[model samples]
Target: MRLALPTAVLVTALTACSAAPPAAVTPVQATPSSTPSVTASAMPRASAGAGEGLPAKLRFTQIAQFDKPVAFAVRKGDDAVYIAEQGGRLHAVKGARTTMIVDLSAEVSKGNEQGLLGVAFHPSGKWLYLDWTDAEGTTHVTEWAFDGTTAKQRRDVLTQDQPYANHNGGQLAFGPDGYLYIGLGDGGGGGDPQGNGQKLTTWLGKILRIDPRGEPYVVPEDNPFKDTRGARPEIWAYGLRNPWRFSFDKETGDLWIGDVGQDSWEEVDHEPRGRGGRNYGWNAFEGDRPFDQGVEAEAAVEPVITYQLGEGGSCSVIAGYVYRGTKIPGLRGHFLYGDFCAGWIRAAPVDDPARTVEVGKVEQLSSFGQGNDSELYALSLQGPVYRVDAP
Candidate 1:
């Protein structure tokens, strides 16, 4: 929507998988699920091959296409991949067939980074979670029961009124800790029009943690600002401009965030498992550089890696996943990422041993999805979702 970088060095501002081959999908009556979230089992590592350590030669294969598909997810123990169309429908991509699961078109307003921006299946494989903006420009994190074809039993997990349409950081993921982590951008307009990033009273421009089924959604007691005065306890981390996409490392439990840039620098922020309360310095700074002198940066957690916006056809940085899939021998521990406009698919090792490597490029890359086996798939907003592969 918002026309939406890499490196190494291991500079420590540093704080900070595999599982069943998918069981049959079980439809539920959209009841509130109290079951713990699913954690990925460790995937077997790939043994080195002839091309091991060979210069990378990546290729893209189109698996499927959809209209304005912005987000996707795999069920806890199922192989079918569910895709979210911005106009408000979830589609399933399995083998040779594609089917629509649900439609919320009457409730969604599509335009300018607004719409159904994210989707996720509950750990029990029964419920489906969605993060999207409604026709009134309000953000809603809703849960519905999935019967493999239609969505039912709608439940509202959370909601926030947006001041502007753009910068609605609506990505959602259930962390290894069994809590849902939400990313929200500062209330849109140019440069954080409301200065929401630095304020503790609001959830915008912050990563929030909550239990979706606990008493109409309860904020976790362990959240960073739980006891802080004036700070909304839902905030797990504050001061992100627009963290469009972020995921938890299935094996290591680390959190990876791709925070979109304001003017020049796009950045990647990392946090170790079990750590929070760190400030990422949005208004005070942008991508490790002093930005707004008006507010001094205090104990800010700078990005581990950042790339200039104008480089490599770069525009907005789409923060992607750390490859733990065994299909690509050389991509084992590397964090795969790309840009919306530049279309170049690049990766930096999660361990940061080597500098960022340019893998390959594509057109209009919007999002990246992981299969049940941990393999990586690239979703282009234009239509084709490519499977990133190598010989």
Candidate 2:
């Protein structure tokens, strides 16, 4: 749903609470535990120079404009940036020319959170994928054969019935391992009343890994839950509320997720390469604190970053990428992220997330894009797309 905004900040203090033991194999869990906070004294010091201050001052140059652009993507070795609008039109923005690449407005749902949500290109650049909600509010991850100028031979890869209108986790990326990774939210109701987050049998509230080239899709043989009885074989990780956006560091292959919290807190989760089967406390925890009192969470991994929900008018976290592009030397190895409501962008070193610094801002920020050159771009639901350039 289109979220309402709050005008003020509500400070969030780190709180700890012991949870009752976890139930066997069922969904539901406690809020998570918080990691130790990093002191200001530990942060990288700002300097006056080019590429200075945590990564150098950033200039977001307006590169293109679209109709409610929600996601951006890049094809391998291609200079064009693909923009996906909530209304189901995909456009290729290359230099001064913008071309319509695809249109599915008739098939996409019109809800605030529904519609065309994410787009990605396969590593081979021959395939394009889209994650969107149908008219019935069902999520679909579809694939198409793309030959640069056009897309054809459409096929369905995965489908899930969403229980509610909001919290449709729509993020798709091809990981370093060459497998397609998909993020799904805990089937949308307040606090996961359906208990999908910790439920092994369901794909909801999980990050799934599969080879979309297979018929429909093929679960990787090495998937974390592939051999686990009653578990969805495609599941790589579970226990997430709403993973709005996620990306792999181009250089390190680490996974970074911006999982929107229920209330009070918002978080960014980081998982090192090859660490699958992680449970990021959802109903059980919200940004390192207990959320649902009745649910016992598994050994959950706490988020590396958390902030008050209304801190500086912040609402949902929009996860970006780790800057590895040569255009900004100081930005290399730093993870970039922002908030949907607050519209401010910040960056933290991959090695030390707590040592963060504000870098830029984009009003109505919906998503970020990393190009084939590894440079970054930010999208706004209001239409403008900006390229993050060194100032």
Best by TM-score: 2
lDDT of 1 by residue, 1-391 (tens): 1222111100110011111221222221211112211111111222234123523656677677676567879987776888887668778878767777777888986655777888877667777889888998999999988867678889898899998777888788888888888888887876676788888899999989888876568888788899999899989988888888898888898998989887777888888898988899988888878878897656988787687766654667787888888878788888887777677767766655124666766665678888878888887665566677764
- Position 320, candidate 2: lDDT: 95
Name model 1 segments beyond 4 Å from true.
1-55
Q: Which residues of candidate 2, in runs, are more than 4 Å off? A: 1-56
Error of 2 at 53 (Å): 4.2
Give one digit per residue, the lDDT tens place, for model 2 in 81-189.
8989877888887767778888889999977777898898999999999999999999999999999998999988999999887778889999999999998888786
**Cα-based lDDT at residue 75, candidate 2:** 91
- Residue 60, candidate 1: Cα error in Å is 1.6
User: lDDT, candidate 2, residue 236?
Assistant: 94
